[model samples]
Target: MNQNVLIIGATSGIAEAVARHFAEQGARLFLVARNSEKLQAISADLVARGALEVATFVMNANETDRIPQMTDAAWKVHGTIDVALVAHGTLPDQQRTETNIAYAIAEFRTNAESVIACLAALAQRMEPQGKGVLAVIGSVAGDRGRPGNYLYGAAKAALDTYASGLRARLFKSGVHVLIIKPGFVATAMTVDLNLPARLTATPDRVACDIQLAIAKRRDVLYTPWFWYWIMLIIRWIPAAIFKRMKL
Candidate 1:
């Protein structure tokens, strides 16, 4: 069956991989991104790879006022959206954010506020239809605040909490909300960070995990699976020890 899928932040590595995965499965795609050039390229690529239809939109997601309008337009393309993925975020410099309130707020707006705005718009549409999958990419870092990137971690943590509450609210409406917690994904987001190869997954690999989670209607997902236990251990550590340890 051909399904209508909307991908916000569609130009990101994981989102692009997800688009290709869905295209192979014969989905109609509505892709949104801040970069018009990248959005057009992705749309063209999906069309060539066998997507049923591909629509592209360019907008900065941080402009909360624009989200509802953009989301509605995207959904209008296929009449209904079977799946929507919110995959945009930033990895801010920890020291910069710590000292600069402006930088901190900017990162927060991108990582958390913008995501919530998009989700709220999608939920308004999906809840009425009684069925749809809303998935967002968070991170394992959200589970705990490490000194390394606590600002980014806090933003993701906020997203995780919001998604949890949203999932419960949408349950009665039959809309499934999925929160994806990825440990170390080797996308451009993590290009400069020194993460272990064994622990880091490629965007394609994480994309496959996301597809599976959506299909299963999983509430919260740790991509690569083992991150579930890793987070469990981290979350259980005593605060004193956790604070002192170099993450």
Candidate 2:
């Protein structure tokens, strides 16, 4: 059977990588992002690269009311979405968010609320189908809040909790819910940050891991796997010492 995959935030970075991976698998794609030009370019590229089918939706995820309309259009094109990859995200400067309440609010809305609303809409449709996978790209930063990017971490933490609950709720329905926690992915999101090469992951690597996890029906995955152990240790650290250290 041909698979239909819907990927949010497909214009750049990890989402784009995920799209390429699924396209290579001959999955029909419905790519979503705010930029129409980029989405069209991606759609064309995917079709040229041997995708079964390709479509694009230009809508800001922050505009929650437009979600149903956009989703319905995708459903019409692809018939039924077999996989929904919720990978839309924004990473604002942490220091700026500290002083600007508006910036912090925007970050929360972009990273947390928008994802929740869109995923909830998708889940409602997919639950009744009883044969779909809902995969979200989260961050290892959510595992333990560090002094550097606590705001982003907090938003990701909320998403992690939501995905966990969604997984439990949808288990009996045969709809798989996966939460991907990638540690320090080298993408546009982390281009400015100095990170250790040993610990950092590329988007292609992360995308491959995501495909494997979905195929295995894994509930939660830490990209590179070693981050799972690393986060486990970090999660156990005492707040007194953790707060002082710059992680």
| Top of the candidates by TM-score | 1
lDDT of 2 by residue, 1-247 (tens): 5689999888769888888888887889999999999888889888887799998889999999999998899889988889999999988799999999999999999999999998899999899989899999889988877878889999999999999999999999999999999988999878988989998989999999998898889999999899999999999989888888877
lDDT of 1: 0.92
Best by lDDT: 1
Candidate 1 positional error at 195, Å: 1.6
- Per-residue lDDT value at 164 in model 1: 93
Model 1 agreement with the true structure over 69-99: per-residue lDDT tens digits: 8977886778999999999999999999989
Candidate 1 Cα deviation (angstroms), residue 119: 0.7
TM-score of 1: 0.98
Candidate 1 pairs with clashing backbones: none
Residue-level error in angstroms, candidate 2, position 162: 0.5
Give the TM-scores of the predictions, in the order they appear: 0.98, 0.97
Residue pairs with backbone overlap in model 2: none
